[model samples]
Target: MQEIHPLLQPKKYRFIDQSTLGPGFSALQSFAMDDALSISVGEQISPTAARLWVHHNTIVLGIPDARLPYIDKGMDYLHEAGYEVIIRNSGGLAVVLDEGVMNLSLIFPNSKDLNIHEGYDAMVEFVRFLFADLTDEIEAYEITQSYCPGKYDLSIGGKKFAGISQRRVKQGSAVQIYLDVTGSGYERAALLKHFYEISKLGEETRFEYPTIDPSVMASLNELLGTSLTVEDVRERILKQLSEFSEAVVTHPLEGEEIEWFTKRLDQMIVRNEKARENLK
Candidate 1:
């Protein structure tokens, strides 16, 4: 689907703008809240949430990321290096998160008519339109050598700056993405590459994971040849959401949502524990 056609599918997205949250409680809380909100508000609410959040010096790893042969060593490396590594209950592999990185979650109610590809396409289309003013060359193809390579890896000129993943709770689908708004994307890639090397240590596994070439990643500031900050992209995100919605209102996690998050947080911790065990 191209520009005009996809924009026509204006699914109402909620605006949970928390663009300046740090490590520990804030990141964990927001993720758990949104994960639970996606399920509780799925079909009944039919409300899609567009959340913007940032965490400093954190590495959000995928479920499979913990399956790396050298995971213990990898996590140790990251921890010793002063990065907080946590396993995310979403799709995609390990990705660096910091104040410079901006994350958006487009939560949609899953209709019987919608499949996984459609869910992925909705975000692909939303993102394409989100940056329509900048350039139309953004392609959603698998950028090999890019960490977390998938069909939804959004790239410009062969270098990837954004990756999208999905989380389904009941009938709600949360398509989340981490945009490397600023900073050294190559540095992040290098870190993942090192993580892989430390984990694998030349041992073979059936999973067939990525070796990460570091060169295939770069920040939007580097790609655009201009100094653009996460706040700049954050503004662009708000403007784009307004263009697609009937009303753009800021909402917080309700008490019920908080309770669901508490439960989900426990599940997330369990998943993280199991993930960490796989590294050994």
Candidate 2:
């Protein structure tokens, strides 16, 4: 196994887990929270932080996804299907978030000196370490037929189970990943596939959206043949963090961090509304 990146070797890490917050925890707040942590870490007010979040039955779309010719209809279809849709402030196509999916964010400072691929590699290495005991077959490569496909997509046996995205703010970087811990990955992919089908309507567009193949995706439980819940993965993450750092401290947002979160949340709301309206 490759050595973990130095960025992952911090002496202390601030840990925040929001996975059990239930249905009210919106993806918007999650993104804003990451931004606040990024700014705090970049300014040296806080140590490098790792946050865990989960949103129920929501579809987070990339900025370009808003430009689909018939996005309004697609949004309606998702809403009618009991899913909340929002545009994320990061790069990546649409991805499904549900009780079965777990999202993790690692915020690091001095991003100016950090290569983009280095940040990604840190995440890849950490995940592989987390599941090293279960299987060593995890691979990082573009799973072209999966929803939110990217070069950093994590897969096993050519079937994707996770996708990663990164956002930078105030010289700090947040490397975010969504892992399909438990559930039917095919159902999730089929949802996004139908979304693109309705949104594009076969209309030729400049930005090419992925042609999702639901069969190319599977949850960890399905692939590993072990029933692991989101909470199980959450425990594994905290355990690994403790082993990697001198101390893993559970901390809540305080002082200026709360103010930063409020501002970032407002910005995200405005950005989302404008993107949706422009498409309409």
For all the candidates, what are their Cα RMSDs to the real structure? 2.2, 0.9
- Estimate TM-scores for all models: 0.92, 0.98
Which segments of model 1 are wrong by more than 4 Å?
1-12, 25-27
Highest-lDDT candidate: 2
Off by over 4 Å in 2: none
> Taking the tens digit of each residue's C-alpha lDDT, what string does model 1 give over 1-280?
5544342245565688777654644556667867877876574553667788888888888877777776888899999988988987665688888778888887777534477787788777777887777778888899889888988999999999999888777877777888887889999999889988898899989877887999999988788777778888888888878777776777777767777888988887887777666666
Instruction: Give lDDT per model, in order.
Output: 0.79, 0.94
Give candidate 2's error at residue 246 in angstroms. Answer: 0.4
lDDT for 170 in candidate 2 is 81
